[model samples]
Target chain A: MRNTIGEVAKKFNLNISTLRYYDKEGLIPNLEKNESGIRIFDEEAVSALIAIECLKKSGMSIKDIKTFIDWCQEGDETLKERLEMFLARREALQSQIKELESTLNYIEYKVEYYTKAVTDGTEKMVKETMSNPRLLNLQ
Target chain B: MRNTIGEVAKKFNLNISTLRYYDKEGLIPNLEKNESGIRIFDEEAVSALIAIECLKKSGMSIKDIKTFIDWCQEGDETLKERLEMFLARREALQSQIKELESTLNYIEYKVEYYTKAVTDGTEKMVKETMSNPRLLNLQ
Candidate 1:
């Protein structure tokens, strides 16, 4: 059985318009349309949609996603290329994770600083004595 | 001495237009202007800019950032609010980091699968035997 675009969007927590736009952009390879021109999302289409969402969340641009999808359609001839792409994606995600960790550390420092200030009814003493130099330099 | 907006933008790796827009939106509290109305970024203004970038990176909306900056200008009266805001940001960053880690794992699985496929020069056997249920389920 196949799902309609609306059913798939609801299941995936994605906007109906976004799915339509993705179809319009030809981002979903081999996506089907019924006689009435409504989308018929099969298992393969759903799999492509999931990969699109994952790649997007990993910061791949729409244009790059199109290239990646095209490569997928080319079969094992592009296996090496796909491997290199995933390795690049891995590097990008690692840097992003590191950046978020640093930001989290900064926020944690602020939380501690504010906790003390809220208790003391003033931040003068806390500001004078407490400092996270790495966080301080980041800002 | 104060820095020009251009100098500050280059130092922070931010766009000059973005800085001007932030100033226009009053997102940077106490940002100074010279006799000709050009921005004069003082140490405090630079500090505010850094916080703005950090909060933006943490996924805070510009509207929410403006409110946070306003709270900062309100002195110790907003201490509790600032603490709560940072706590919320901490939670957000933690979740984002976790999501990226999950995506990274999925990509690493794909990398290994593709590497083996490239070595065999065909994915038939490898695709049949090697499966990552989590990655497959994600798609």
Candidate 2:
């Protein structure tokens, strides 16, 4: 049995308005309408919704995702294009992950810097430690 | 000898306007001025600029960073508050890194899914493979 848009949205923990927005944006590829003009969500529509959420969380814009959905609807002829899209997105995510890793390192440095300052009763202690010629010569 | 704003900007590969904006925003706690009223950047000023860039990249806002500089300039009395601010920001950066890592996993899954679609000449093939009763039973 198929579910109404409201039921599907509740099951997915998303707002009903979000489902309507997705349908309006053409992101919901297989939105089936009933005799009374209410939207019905089938297994295919549920799958599409899940895929859309996944792609969006991975930083794909809604416009790009719509293009990907269109390519999917076009069948085997668009397989190469779909693959290229994923490749580009994967590469971009890798770059972002690397940048975040560096940012994490900087944050860790701040954590240590502050932890010592807290222990020593003043940040000046940390600064003095860094600048002490005696400590530098010992190192 | 001190460096001009232009020299410092070029040294850090930042736009001259960014350094000016940082000074105007109180991010540079030690912007020295020469007799000609031209901004002069000494070693300490350069260090503060570097620290500002580091904190900004860690996602601190200019206004909040100005607060941090104000605390630093207030000497030992504000050490606890400054330390707490860095600790809070460090915790925030860790959370952001974790979220990005989860997003990276989703992107990796898409990469694999699309790679198979490319290999099989159609995304329908991947869907069929995923739903096969034999595969389901094995899993």
Candidate 3:
């Protein structure tokens, strides 16, 4: 099925401008156009866009995504390279998850300390409770 | 020990411009100036900057970090609100992690499918594999 830009935008819950930007960025390849010069995207293009969105959220840059797509279109010769890219990204994502988990832990600790300080109603206790070498270094 | 912006930037492997930008953004609230009005950041400021870097990587925006700092300076009354904010961010980060995980799964599936197609060397199999229902919806 072919979809107009507006229809796709509504369906995907994306802005028209973002769709246009992606098209210009070569993130969406070979879009079909009507006689009036409007973009008419088919199901293949939509699928590719979905894949692009997935890669984007995984922190793959547009250039890297374009390279991946090129490899996809090129077939067997690039399969190993493509697999390596996926594995690398998976590792990166794992690291990011770990980092975020650590940050969450720090935030939780702060929240608990602050909560205690507020309930206890003593500035000295609050200072003592909140004061930490770690807190001093936090942004 | 006080450090020049250049020294601090090099120490942190950050651009000097980033320090200036952070100063302008009020991410570092207590930065001192030297005799020539040059920025002179103390150890405490460096620690704060490190924390800011951590928060930034965890997807906190400069404005949100500033709000957090404001709460920090406001004392006990803001503790509950601050804790709520951190909790909300934790939830958001969890959702973001889930989204990334889903994307990673999708990428892994694609990579595996492509690997199999490349190994089989059958155009028919490749075509059939590419016609996944997930890809269909995206189109």
Candidate 3 clashing pairs, residues 3+ apart or interchain: A43-B139, A46-B138, A47-B138, A47-B139, A139-B51, A139-B52
At residue B86, what lDDT does model 2 achieve? 76
What's the best-to-worst order under TM-score? 1, 3, 2
Q: Give me the candidate number with maximum DockQ.
A: 1
Candidate 3 C-alpha lDDT tens digits along A8-50: 9998888999899988877777788989899998977888788
lDDT of 2 by residue, B79-123 (tens): 788778878887877776676666666666667777888888777
TM-score of chain B of each: 0.93, 0.86, 0.83
Answer with 2 or 3, whichever has the higher lDDT. Answer: 3
Which stretch of 10 consecutive residues in model 2 chain A shows the poorest summed lDDT?
A130-139
TM-score of chain A of 1: 0.93
- Reference-based TM-score of each model: 0.93, 0.74, 0.83
Query: Which pairs of residues collide in candidate 2?
Result: none
lDDT of 1 by residue, B53-121 (tens): 889889999999999999988999999999999999999999999999988888888788888899999
Q: Kindly report which residue stretches of model 1 are placed more than 4 angstroms away from their true locations once superposed.
A: A134-139, B135-139
Note the DockQ of each predicted structure.
0.76, 0.44, 0.48
Error of 2 at B79 (Å): 2.0
Better of 1 and 3 by TM-score: 1
lDDT winner between 1 and 2, please give it: 1
